[model samples]
Target: MVDTMKAAVFQGEGRLEFEERPIPQIERADHVIVEVGAVGICGTDLHALKVPPGTLSRIPTGVIMGHEIAGRVAEVGEDVLSVKPGDHVLVDQNAPCGMCEMCRRGRPNYCISIRNVPGFPGAPNTYGLFQDGGLAKYVRVRELNVIRIDRSVPIWQAAVAEPIGVGLHGLRKVNVRVGETAVVLGAGPIGLVVTALLKRSGVGQLIVVEPLELRRQAALACGATAVINPKEADTVERVLAETNGTGADIVAEAVGWTLDTCIQVASNGARIILYGESELDDVIPIAPTLIGIKELEIYGVFLAPFVFESARSILESGTLPLDQIVSHRLPLEKVHEGLDALRDGRALKVVIHPNEF
Candidate 1:
């Protein structure tokens, strides 16, 4: 085994430096070392790289930046028993402190100490953002954060489990039912995933709103019955027209600042889930009275709490058109290009192979 490995380190805003980092070793009895095969460049990574940074500005400089990770276990601590060396695995980026009040109440997703809280101890928080992650040849993970996958599954597909889990969490929160009209604002990666899941859940009419023609087509492939180009038409009117003037039963804001559109297109007693959050400082104007008058239920989705296993199962089922979703696959060195592609709306999901080069 080599002593040093190449890693992509965050260098403040708008910079990612390639550097040689020491190969991590198991410091704890439950620590596991993984030989990284693939990691997905997420929207959060792009947000962190923005000038002045976006919502993910809290990500410390020098941290390796990739959370959607999948690899084979290279080593396991003495106390680790669930997985062994050579096991294919996916890493759950969100490692909430299990002892927190929110976690004890069965809501680890709302754990106050999920992130590195000041003066708090043992807050694993999240991988890639708060700590060194898998945008490198190797990553050290706690056994609790590692979930073993079938060896036959491709590493690239496994790497997307995190985002898929996010979609699942949002879908669960909205309590989607069969034969309902659903409108997804934005056909980005998360929206596409949610569209696919909503289709699989038997939604009768799935409408997607996106300005980009490429993503609109991708949304159709993901089972969207109709797609609206917000740039070309009034999104709210189109959604209501698609639903025969009743509007949609469920609305998902996946474009991060389309909450207004989601609210405008939702039917009475509809459920809305906000899945995109790229900017922490962004605030949209909305009519609060409409929420109560319409009897609408609005939910803000955070990290995937308990849907990792289901996400993996969905990926393994081979039901989704994974090729349509993963638009680009680049080596670790070209992560900048991947980020650029996502930023420019030229790519959907970009997977990075850290060990390929």
Candidate 2:
């Protein structure tokens, strides 16, 4: 059966329009259709519509655009047993080759075969970026992306799991411990979630560095022991002061292009987790001599792998109170304004509902 549903399609030059497209159906035994109820506007979507970096530089000008989604299962193919109709669900953004070394090492986010991720359509039909993303009335997740959430859980709060998974990966990369102090740079959704997770994981103390006032407040709400507004004082001094001049035990740098901040504030033996993807042109003056002398470890993390099971549990338990981060809710028809709001930094996690709102 064919199903055409209202969807937000990327038009061009920072614009999105509501269009009617055929709802994806199960052609493969493991495929499942999800009726999207809540989709978050991630930074990538806004960046694609505005700046268009990387493979997104030459966006084809027409496609579905979004990566954060939470919804209910519409139909499941015969081979699908993990989720059922009426099941509340969240989508894992990364797909991996289970046999790769990275996957074998429990890091599916770094799948060596990521160049040609399947199920999702994108550039070259082989390169998936702006060609087709998750912002739609319905999406055909390869069952690989589907993780069931408890029916009692609010779908909107569960939607926060994707970014939390990002934090999960970062913290795991940094090898964070119960008593370790952590400094999270950037107070956006990802940073806020990272701080929240760090607190939940029992970090001794956490300092959040953000330039925006509202974001600083959000960090406080997320359990940040200290909020650093870089403009008011030296960010490094603030973080160092909080650490008793010893510096943080771990620094999760979620703000790309701010590598200098990590270098100036980290204590000896501190592990730095680089999670942000900033502009390529942006450069930081890293003092290699100091880094080498400090015996600091640097780790890079991309997305989550095989983490959906644990991520769902955290989401279901309502640990982070994520629904409070949502700044605006608009219908699929008004996605442009939502994207614009995200680009302008006016909203924290603007979401688009399929129909009901």
lDDT of each candidate versus the true structure: 0.88, 0.76
TM-score of each candidate?
0.95, 0.90
Candidate 1: give the clashing pairs. none
- Measured by lDDT, the strongest candidate is 1
Positional deviation of residue 80's Cα in model 2 after best superposition, in angstroms: 1.4
Residue 289's lDDT within candidate 2 is: 80
**Which residue ranges in model 2 land beyond 4 Å of their true spot?**
52-60, 97-107, 116-131
CA displacement after TM-score superposition, residue 343 of candidate 2 (Å): 2.2
Candidate 2, residue 309: CA error in Å?
1.4
**lDDT accuracy of residue 296 in candidate 1:** 94
Off by over 4 Å in 1: 116-124
lDDT of 1 by residue, 39-120 (tens): 9988888877888777444578889889999999999999999999999999998777778788899998767656443344
Model 2 earns a TM-score of 0.90
List clash counts for every candidate, in order.
Answer: 0, 0
